[model samples]
Target: MVLGVLGALLVPSLSSPASAAGDATVVVRGTDLPVGGPIELSYVGCARLYERTAEVPQPFVGLGPDQAPAGERSLRYDLAGGTALGSLSYARSMASTTTSGLSVQAPRGAAGVAWVGYQEPADFGTTTYWFGRADVSAPAGAWTSVETTGLTYTWSRYDMATRRAVGGATAAPSTLAAMIAERGDGPGFRTVGFGCDGNRFALDALRVGDATGTTTYDLEGLTTTTVMAARPAPRGTVLTGVLRDGSGEQVVRGTLVLERQVAGGWETVQVVPAEAVDATVTVAPEQTTTYRWRFADRPLAEGSVSEPTTVTVAPGQETSQEPTQQPTRQPAQR
Candidate 1:
């Protein structure tokens, strides 16, 4: 009989899937999005994962400008180890002001919010040029997660050419609920998004709702790659594996299961904790056996498995190698 002493397996996790540049824009209906357009929209840049803040450690988008001079009129989001992308835009019916909120991490002076749509009884005719600077700030070194439907902002009549308020700002800040009620039966939102030229900030878990239901958009997606290797050692065999994200960065934390092939199907050999990026095991197998590593599905990351690894042993070689550590046999679990 032989025992395998395995080290804890360490693998990181992502919040959700990612939407990269050049990919098809994502769209959702019943939310009053633009006709035949994306639910997640960006012009100066695209949306990508950002992990600089503890409050928003998930795959959130960081909005800012590209390589432009200060005060340049740009809408962008900066991606880690990548170029600056554009601001984010979502289609929503301003008419439905049931509830709305978003998680934001911003620095001082970050112009992190906006709303563009229609307004009635305006000096300027109804050309759908209503822009509100919802510049909500966050506490120092913290992220803000607050309901916004009842929040207030002083809207200004927008000018298409200047992309700024045309006339004096409204008398006082008005809540979305009030704005919707005042608009009456006017056309709702043309587009709602985040970005003030030259102001860099981060956002996550954006939520909006109407009479129907609420929808939270978190940019939601990511892909993973895992690999396994087997080599001859003083013991019978040494098995090792690692898991990584799409950018080839090693995953930070998770549990990986060591699986072995049996007559019925693959069976669990042991549970490996990912305290580190790599997982290793020393096994003195009686015969040649095939093994692999598996990561189960998590809240933010998808499930994945490593390529199969095979360890070959000669008849007398299995028990001949000296042991490096005391072998603690772990009972296989289903």
Candidate 2:
């Protein structure tokens, strides 16, 4: 895997041209190029990155007609739609403050980017280069990530109103998995749903405009659902919330549900069916609990749930919420 801020150019072979030219001389060409989109960055490196750039740099080629050795990996193309090259920036942050700037031809899109830097698989010295489509435009927002190989980039359509990233950075499959170590790809970019991964993150508040953003994924690392039977002696032993109608009638056997934030995203932890009285949720004690649940999917949207309830099991507390506390035996005085 070659790491780099700028995508190296590609070599023109008998089957491939030096550039992808089209009838429209508008600049970046090709339907694949994300036009009027945001900016995204990724890193890729190999032996070739260290190579000194002469007056001009060579372009990296993609999987060509020529095949590599059976065991070796082939150099594939890394590009945005219309063969858009990446936009790079460097910055520093401290005490929650950030200072940053970008270095590229076009501030946002491919308007100024003319080259894509490519390196040999594993070996950076074996590099190639390819110019981008002339019509390449500028990116709106920027998303950048650095890896062992190089820095990754993402340019997106910025929601000028909320000042958040709504569009996605075109990323490789490996990139997604690496972002969420233990996550699996499901429906709606479910692999790395809305969350932070110490990278240029695309954040949103889950609005109706963001149809592609609202992803549904199964949460991992649930460990176990410890049960704490309810008891009358203790006002409450099992963590729970009451469900009722506008009239305030005891909603017996209605439903209970749990949502958990994991792997840089939120997912359903538990879902109690309708007509189920209270719910007995099991979880290890932790801080900063952020989750949401659906009560009465029936649309009445009646009762409001208790703000994400958190519990801290003391040192010797019984797993089950018993009415009385167990006797504590002090260690023998040394």
Candidate 3:
């Protein structure tokens, strides 16, 4: 079934985190955190029964806990790990045990993956787990994996911005790099973790890393029409327009380019920062002109031009002529 494939791809047997190319990897070893550390864990729906531990559960080995994959400590989750269905409660109950200081930058052709090792007893039944960037939403049944009575490592590659899977689950490093070159350009920090529907599980050795590649997201139809504030105005009028992305969502950051229809072609007039929903600029054109806005090209989004708008400038007022001379002559005669 597609669900089974997705689960197998999203969740693999425990393995070591992939190494970063040129020191670009960020890792969070479970043993590094203090025991009984304060963490924020939330359960899906209204079910709020869960617990966590940061110690080696030697006694729980019979119940499916395993030694830390890389260090002296491993994070343990018990009580209701596999009780919930993957379709209803996948990662709905999870925690942010530590801060991942991974900074994703836009316009930089970058791609990365998050990996974690977990151990579950054979009796835990079918439980799903996932680790990736925080904002990522794994498809229902994507993270389901049947945990055997031992430790295994699983990893999921993400496009970074959309957090969608890059290639299939358990994608090879080269495949991940190529996928990044094709689509993983949006920027965001990475995260890793394990989750279950009420089965006991232990997780350790979280890691994220990136590589450089020339790839950009296709945002061809993601742009909306440019909305101008005023159509006809004086030569020295301020022209304003709002720039949005492929989904018609206003871009709050980055650069919006203003272009004018010149004698032969379109010429860029100004490159303004997208600081708000709308961007404004003063234009004193010598004649009527056609103008448009576009986003500066970035890794995650391609540069797109908005619909052009023509602004009509009123002609200069005609100078008053002979009336002044006639009035002066009449005054002299009086």
lDDT of 1 by residue, 165-207 (tens): 5666453568655765766533333222333333355545545
Compare the candidates by TM-score and give the number of the best one. 1
- The clash numbers for all candidates, in the given order, read 22, 76, 18
Cα RMSDs, all models: 15.3, 23.4, 21.2
- Name the lDDT of candidate 2: 0.26
lDDT per residue for candidate 2 within 1-334, as digits (tens), equals 1122332222221111101222111111111122222222223221122222221212221111122211111112223222222322211100110111122211132322222222112322333211111111223333221111112322222222332334552234232223223232111110001111111112111101121121111101101121223222343334444555533444433554555556876555555543445554444423434444435322112334445543445566544432123223321111
Q: How does each model score on lDDT?
A: 0.45, 0.26, 0.33
Error of 3 at 184 (Å): 37
Top-lDDT structure, candidate number: 1
Measured with C-alpha atoms, the lDDT of residue 211 in candidate 1 is 52
Q: Write the per-residue lDDT of candidate 3 for residues 49-162, one digit (tens) a residue.
A: 122322222211111122333323333334333221111011111121112211111121212223321212221223322222111112232122221111122345433234
What candidate 1 gets wrong by more than 4 Å, as runs, is 1-92, 105-116, 119-128, 140-144, 161-164, 167-172, 187-203, 218-287, 293-303, 314-334
Better of 2 and 3 by lDDT: 3
Q: How close is candidate 1 to the true structure, as a TM-score?
A: 0.45
- C-alpha lDDT of residue 258 in model 3: 71
